[model samples]
Target chain A: MKKQLMTGVLATLLSSTTMAATDITWWHAMSGQLGETVNTIARDFNASQDEYNIKPVFKGSYVETLTAGIAAYRADQAPNILQVADVGAATIINARGVAKPVEDILVESGYGFNNQDYIAGVRNFYADSNGKMIGMPFNSSTPVLYYNKDILAKVGVDAPKTYEEMEQVASKLKEQGYATFSQSLTPWIMFENFKSRHNLPVANKNNGFDAPATKIMINTPDMAMHFNKLKDWSDKGYYKYYGSDWDANQTPFEKEQVAMWLGSSGSFGGLRNRVDFELGTTYLPYWQSMNKDAGRTFIGGAALFAIDGKPKKEQQAVAAFFSFLTSPETQMFWHKSTGYVTVTKAAYALTKKSGYYQEQPDAEVGVKQLSLPGGEWTKGYRLGFYSQIQEIMHREFDNVFANRISVEKALNNIDKESQVILSRFARTVR
Target chain B: MEQRQQYTHSALPYFLLVPQIAIIAIFFFYPAAEAVYLSFMLEDPWGQSSLFVGLENYTILFNSTEYLKSVVFTLGFALVVSFLSLSIALLLAVKANNILHGKGAYKITLTWVYAVAPAVAGIMGGFMFNPHIGVFTEIFASLGWDFSLYTDPFDATFVLVLVSVWKQVSVNFIYFLAGLQSISYAVNEAAMLDCESDRRRFWTITFPLLAPTGFFLLVINLTYAFFETFGVIDTLTSGGPGGGTTSLVYKIYRDGFIGTDLGGSAAQSVVLLVLVLALTWVQFKFVEKRVHY
Candidate 1:
């Protein structure tokens, strides 16, 4: 009778320890300072409640982490939370059985989601057809124009706010023998950001949100003219081609060799520490003919996904952690440390009230740009295999910049090639 | 006379071979068969949805101009890299074998690059050929050459070949050096007595004897150029400057992993496998005859 009592006591101890905390694993790509911020948020959440232990794991770059997560899901070892890049968002979302919709998770956990709580551009980007949130927006960024103040001052021009003004400023700077402008060969800044800011559709089917995108829609006259203008700038030596390497132009911009550059707002905090020159930030220029006011710039960073097929208790833990992530305090802390845009209005207001924007006005450019009124086309890209499409764009754009192909030919080639990829993706879904 | 082992009839011999066969079956045959099966089907990135579209992937690949261009580029790249690396390494190996002073140091220095991984070599090459602050870029600038790897296809190809050949030469060098050292001293002395010129003696004695090694290295170098250069291409150019440097292996990787076009990538791998098989067959059937044992 005494031995039986001891066994009962051991069983009780084991069960109590196991039931004390539900461990929720989060596979993220954030590293360095950003990684530290992620860890802090996890630690804070763990400290606040003992029911869920939010475990954050650094899983390499955005691509590597997404690949790992997908492979893990296939093997039935997926984490509760997986961070996927903005481009890979479609891939993750299209895998219907792989992800548990944020709306469902939140509603089930008794913390219901309000679409209005998130910035329209951000919330809409991760929303489904019925406008329900599928994933939680975490680290978001938009491209903005950055210029060297002393170099622009020498050319006697303030930072150009429109495409026409940018060209005029380029001409003026060229007259002074300055390499007036440069940008990375990334289609993120040139195509996606440019199209959204000009209120143009990148692909058909309402930028692929209404249905699976079937064809390329970037062959319009407006796109031709915009590309031609860039070609003209290149021919006149007013614009420098930094090749396909994304960070190549950073050196020239920092060295003041290139007067103006289009760069990610996430780089603002790091840039301020890296450069010695006076820097200026502005919204990316839009074609006035297309839209007098700039449309909202889409977010570029990754979002957190709740993997499906986990236990209800585990998913509830994930939902609770996501609520904490969307809280204004966590958002503001993330923005301050990483320079990623605040995804929610409350976070923006809270950050503003703390005087963070006033102390660093340049950091406000990305957030402000993201919060601008947006049209149907201004929502983030929802195309499948978007990164691969970007690679095709990179190759063709490089061809144009190298003088090997004309702009029209390059666009046509991109259209034809991207159509093939889209059709293939569409075939799978069908 | 040496006794001929009749182990072919024994179950013990077969049992002994089980591990090797099992490894080959698991590692090679299974993946190859899966690739063949996948080639006929279209699948999404995560294997969530699949559609069996027989011959469509291959037909599309053949019709696609981009794939055709990549095929031509890959073939040309392999040929050039193989030829250049073999000849260069052979010359260095011969020099090192002949030299008595600092021979050990020279050989060690030449062989050091073999220890570096392909990705590491690509990274080092990337640093040296970086457009903005690369050492080679500065050198080219001083010489008044308009050099930009990101913009110029020729420049990109040149850098790719240079890095690939540099990475591969050390392995070929070790083989050639070993081949040179293995030539019997009596044969060299006899050739020295028979031939008046040192060059003539080398061509008559050393060249033919080293043909076996050269033949082996040619196959190795070609295989390296075809497949092993994926990391170098990925890190240095990522098959850029209008896809001028993309090889078949890199394309398979880009299509499958990056683009998530599983069926298309699978078809590409099958094509590559066939191409490699044909090349090997040709080499062993035709080229091996010229190589003296």
Candidate 2:
């Protein structure tokens, strides 16, 4: 009777162990190569572990994915993990109780939480004012200058070292019948890149990353100067305004109709397979007459946040996945596969030691550009209504480009709209 | 007995309308009521916490220069596009009605063009007018004109209006043709016997007879101009050349979805809904009375 009871207990234990493996849903916006990379990582993790199984789903683009997640949340069917873009950060933050802080998840899961492991510029974005990390650093990237070497060589213009040099090269390229120096005039490229390269403040409180209630500083002298440059170039037919965002302007670059393009470094992997010409990567140019050192470019990619309202077991699983995601090996795999900068210092060191940079020079540009001192603007601006500000800036800048208004008037209008939005956002936060 | 039978027959029709009423109540009326209710409330990023703020959204909208400008812009666009499309469609329909030999072929061709979605037509039109590779751009440049629709607000608006008319004219054309065909040949004979010229007869008799169709087309074209052309704006200009082409619906999309200002967007949407409803009612009261039928 004792032997039969012992056998029965062993059988029940085996069945319960089999049933313990839980499936967690992860909703992401990545597709194509990036999507495959996410799936591969999830597969590797699942294979290595027997307790939790992660199910990855490609929802859509960043906005679409976020909208879908919100809809799902309304229906009480949200995913366990969501990858939100940098622009969506404020929205997520404002969505209190809807997201679990990564720091809390890590601690609860018994993992050692180290905020110092992440790059300061990147980590600061995911952290609250009290210095608690809110999200996991996933694929962080910054904009860089991408030039067609053949076109540059033909125009006798070496890769532009300064904004003035870039202007001169654009003229030469236009003279050589290139017709367009750059395809797209994306607001981020025009405003953020220009602001960071000049070390100009886009807002108070270190471009709003230090304080959320800070107002916009877009109508400043530096911004005016930048606008003037763009306007002059546009008038001179050196810059062809593609109208609106970068996606609309990508056609010309893919066809080699444009000489230069300013876009995220994350595009390197995708462009590598498409472009027929030699693509040279360089740090974004600054005002030549301004200070020689402007620091690193501002980061412009998304991070993964652990949503709130899940069971402790699920939170523990998410934390383990997050920790594994930021590990050096995983970072290297992500960087090599997607051209996004590895967020961790250890990953960068590993890449250096492995001589990956020597093999692929394009990957080195992002690291070198980000290794600079990252001044006030380069720290990555965060505000409650940045997306609105961006839209207003783009609208006003487009007006400037169209000669509908003077650069001064456009800047003033941008300031006015931005102030209104900022004040409204401040009231809400309070 | 006959009066009782007529009452029972009328009751069947009322019973038949019940399902449609249920559908409209569930889908349209409920959401519209909810939008109005939410417009008076403050919204957050998560779209969860909404607090009632009586008339705050409307007051803010009324105070905003941007919102006021968009209102004017949307009104101008809707009026201009509707008139242009109706006039062109009426002319084409009349011309096709006069043609006896190839009217079928003409209608088939026009129908094919109309069958193509507005988005596809907008894309094709964008490429055709694109400054870089567009044939129209080459021609305009050769004529010593700047003619860059992307850079010029007037030019962008012109392109939008032209595309809007092109996409909508076919539907109105069919309506006009149907109206013309339904008119008895006896009316034209009587006008002729009264010594009215062909142009005079058309203006006095045929045109008046087509008023009902015109009114219907006006409502449809105006709504299409307001809502359906969001794709055209998105694909062609994206409300650019400095918000010169941002319609009310497009503004709602940009604010709500792209800018993530749900409260402001919902408020804007409520404003748009009210404007549309008011205009539609006015059109019905004034214009619909002109329809003889």
Candidate 3:
């Protein structure tokens, strides 16, 4: 009886310790301040729950992290959670059997999952047609206008509310020898913003999310007008065409060389830290003459994905942590820290009640823009083979910027390349 | 009995070489063979599965206009960079040979720059050429010229070739210096007795003697231009301004990694391998034959 009691006591100790904690590895690409925020959330979650411990690892940049995850998945050594950029959404969705749906995991774990709680646009991109959420929307943000208030005041121009006013301001700034009025030539900024604001279809079949095999719809007259205006500005020395993307332009703007910069709302935090001069934020300027009813800009930041290859118990752990991530407290913290829009309506309300926005007014811009009533364009484009399409778009835009091809020819080439990619994607999806 | 012993000793060297041969076959030959095999297959991006497509990938690569343009551009770039690097290296080697003071310091400093990572150098070069804030750009602007190297194809090529030559000059200079040092002082005395001009003496004696080193450098510089410059190209232009700055290897990276057309990229790789092999063989047969060594 004594020997049996001793054995039972040892077994009880082992069981208690085993039940005390389960470790889950989350690989993410957030660095610096953002990495600290992720760590804080993980620590809080670990402390709140005695059952599971979430370990967050800082992988490199977004592209590097995604590539590493893909390679690791192929090798059957993938992490439980991965942070993929917005462009990677379609790629992750198409990677069937490689990822677990958050909805299914939640339901299996007996945690009540609701799709309606999330912003429809943000939630739908990560969901299947039957409304299964594939990933949790984390670190989401939309583009906004950032202007140097000092430069604007010096040029005697208010922050431009309309595209025409922006043009006038740009001309005045150039005339006043500001060197550069604005410094980005990214298509997502120049083209996607225009399309979203005017409610123009960027692609057929609700920007190719409803149907994966949709052709490019960006060769319209309005797009031509946008390109022509940019070209005119380039010729007139009113605008300085930086390279193709944000990084190339942000350097000059950070140095206070450029007068205005159109960038993601998440950039508010970065500008607040980096810029010595006073900075002002505004909604992206729209073409007033084209349509009176222009909407918010498309979202640009990334979300979190739950990869496959874990057991049912581990999946439950992931679901729990994901729930904790999307919880009102975590979302509010993320928004207040990073200037990303709160993914959940409750988090937004919580932030408002806490008067976080009152302390930092620029934090409210992302929410205001996303909350606008403009239909599908506001939802942002989702398409299969999106990575390939984005590459083609960047390349053809490079061609235009290089003056190797006309805007019409470049768009036409993009249309052809996109169709080819779309057709291949169609074959697979079908 | 002596002849049999000599044959056994000669055969023992072959036996000794077996391990090295096996290692080469396992590591290098196996992967090269697999790459060749992969050239005939189509890879699905999402599925990451490859299917046999025979010559279809090669056909696509051949028909690609961008690939054709890249081929021409890469060849021209390689030639220009190789010649420029060789010339500068030879000049520096001669100057170092004549220098009486701080010769070791100069050599060490140049060699140290070569040891620095190409990616770091490329980044520094990018900053130095940045149109808005770069010191070089400001100076060029003051001279009344637009110095946007990132946007201009000619300027991009110039920067690429300049960086490539700059990075390589130290290596080639070391090789040439060693070759120059190896030559006997008797040759110079003989030329002096013949009363030849310095230029003529160099052309007739020093140049001919240094042919072996020059030939070696030519091959080394060409290969460097082909493979080693990818980091510089990626960091500097990212094959940008309408793919004007893309070299052959850069195109291979784009096609395989970014384009997700692994088979097509593999086919292009095979073509590149064949071209390099053929060129090397030609250089050995024709150019190396002229070397005095």
Candidate 4:
């Protein structure tokens, strides 16, 4: 019995010395080249730290990974960190004990993280109702106008700025026998980015940032004009609606069949490589002719959250890893690797000093589009049941674009349908 | 019956039954019980927390237009997939059986399609039918027919149905070939000597004899269409062009897993369970009398 006790103690000591670094699993959804970049980030962070080891597991797509993390948490095997899409921020936060607030992590650790260093639009998205950070903004992207220079030159326009001007330009280009624009019919550009660009409230109560929004504000007159404009222009062959998302939308632009393509900044690297045509990217068109209070767009990618119920040591290790990711140097590598927007002001400044933007001007467009001074509605919208809401939005858009209903009726119907989801979600959360 | 032997050791029987019972209990009963329990409760996606809300989830599902539409959609999809796959496979098996030369080669070629994954088959269909890049779409365009699967609901559903039928044809084909081959050549020669036409012999003599196999395949194919067509639908259309192809199973996955409406999704599953149970029961009760066996 004495020998057995001594052997157990010796084994414990051996493990303590050999396995000094605490293991913290990180579940993420990045795939392909972006997946490689995620691994590189973890490897760099692991090399930087002697205390914590982060193991990044690729868990399918965004929805799949988020579901896996949640399923893990339910099974009492959740990882230390989970990378979930920005849409899931509210869902994760609202879930009573699913995630540990990043701000709380920093406060407890007393780590010197300058919150002000984060870009305002990106930072505001992951903040809670009290303006406290809940998730780390990682690989954030926003839509930009990708135009063919040759087509714009033939049409005698530099770059269209407002909705009305774009309409005129599209007409001119079509008259010259070129289809003016082709966009992915996904809700990211049509719903979220459009709302942000026009400073319109997509939902009530400060776009659901201040509190759980009680109503959807997508039926406002400003929203109608944009849809109406798309309707009229689409009737005149000014636009082509591709399949539901970015990869599908890039096909026409890659084929040089369309002049204008509005898509995510994350596709910048691929867009540059695929197109032989002289490509020029500009800001997503605003409705300056309608709403003068329009503001800059917000981020569209996923963020990292420190999951709850982890050991204290594992939590600190996750916090340390997050700090390393948020550093300017690591952020630079991440931005260039994925063509996602730079998350930190210091990172942007350092990239500027490095003359990366001057070397590749296409990378500068998304930053310029999103880094504008804030307006009343500049902060992004978050609500529960957004996945359901997104599907409804797609269906309602088809109603208008497919000639089943007028834009006016479609808008009203969508509002009513969205309210049903909102009310049901309100009940579920309560 | 006359040679039946009773087990002298009762414990031996229990020991022999242990693995099967344990497996069924663990794999099937436990999950079913959990789903039934969750169907009555409002829960988070992770099942981290739940509120017992009685039958509210079922009520909400009943009231939901999307759920109602998906029910009709699932019925139509299963009907189309089952009928098309069975009929097409029957026709192919008949043709292959009629051919005397290279019969093995013909059967082998047809059966090889089963090796392809449903998603991979859907993707192959995409390569053929995609409007922008498809060779078939290009042909249709030249013939003055516009084809855009992504933009048209019927086209989207057609693509899903086509891919699903393509994947399932092999299983149906194997069953059908066995059934067709089981019919004796002596019967066919006798029917011909009796002066019956080829088509008439197939319809009047051979088809009735094959009804048992047909009845068995009908049940299997319906189940396959109802439960196993998710990969095809997801790959080709993602149940879109506005939920045109969203079956009951796909909707459950989207809501429960992707949309994170656990209670609602569970409620959907319970409703689906009752539906399938009723369907299968009716098929077995009434349809079995038509079988020759």
> Model 3 over residues A68-144: C-alpha lDDT tens digits?
78778877888899898777676677656777888888888998888888864566657765567887888888777
Tens digit of per-residue lDDT, candidate 1, span B1-293: 23556544668878999999999999999999999999999987777888999999999999988889999999999999999999999999988998989899999999999998889999999999998879999999999998898788899899999999999999999999999999999998888888889778778889999999999999999999999999899999999878888888999988888777889899999999999999999999999988879
DockQ order, best first, reads 1, 4, 2, 3
Q: Could you give candidate 2's per-residue lDDT for residues A174-259 as a string of tens digits?
A: 88888445645465776766777677776776666555645677778777887787778878877767666575466567677888
What are the runs in model 3 whose C-alpha is more than 4 Å off? A1-20, A178-180, A183-185, A255-257, A428-430, B1-19, B46-49
Q: Which residue pairs of candidate 1 clash? A: none
Worst 10 residues of 3 chain B by lDDT: B42-51
Off by over 4 Å in 2: A1-20, A31-33, A167-180, A183-186, A197-200, A247-258, A270-276, A352-355, B1-18, B48-52, B189-196
Model 4 CAPRI quality: medium
Model 4, C-alpha of B181: deviation from truth (Å): 1.7
Q: After superposition, how far is residue A66 of candidate 1 from its true place, in Å?
A: 2.0
Tens-digit lDDT track for model 4 on A321-403?
Answer: 88888888999998888899899999999999999998789897887777877776778887877888788777767667777
Worst 10 residues of 1 chain B by lDDT: B1-10
Q: Residue B258 lDDT in model 1?
A: 79
True contacts kept of each: 0.74, 0.44, 0.27, 0.47
Each prediction's DockQ against the real complex: 0.71, 0.38, 0.36, 0.51
Best by lDDT: 1
lDDT of 1 at A338: 92
**Higher DockQ: candidate 1 or 4?**
1
Q: Cα RMSD (Å) per model? A: 3.4, 4.7, 3.9, 4.1
lDDT of 3 at B28: 84
Cα error, residue A103 of model 3, in Å, equals: 1.9
- DockQ, 0 to 1 scale, candidate 4: 0.51
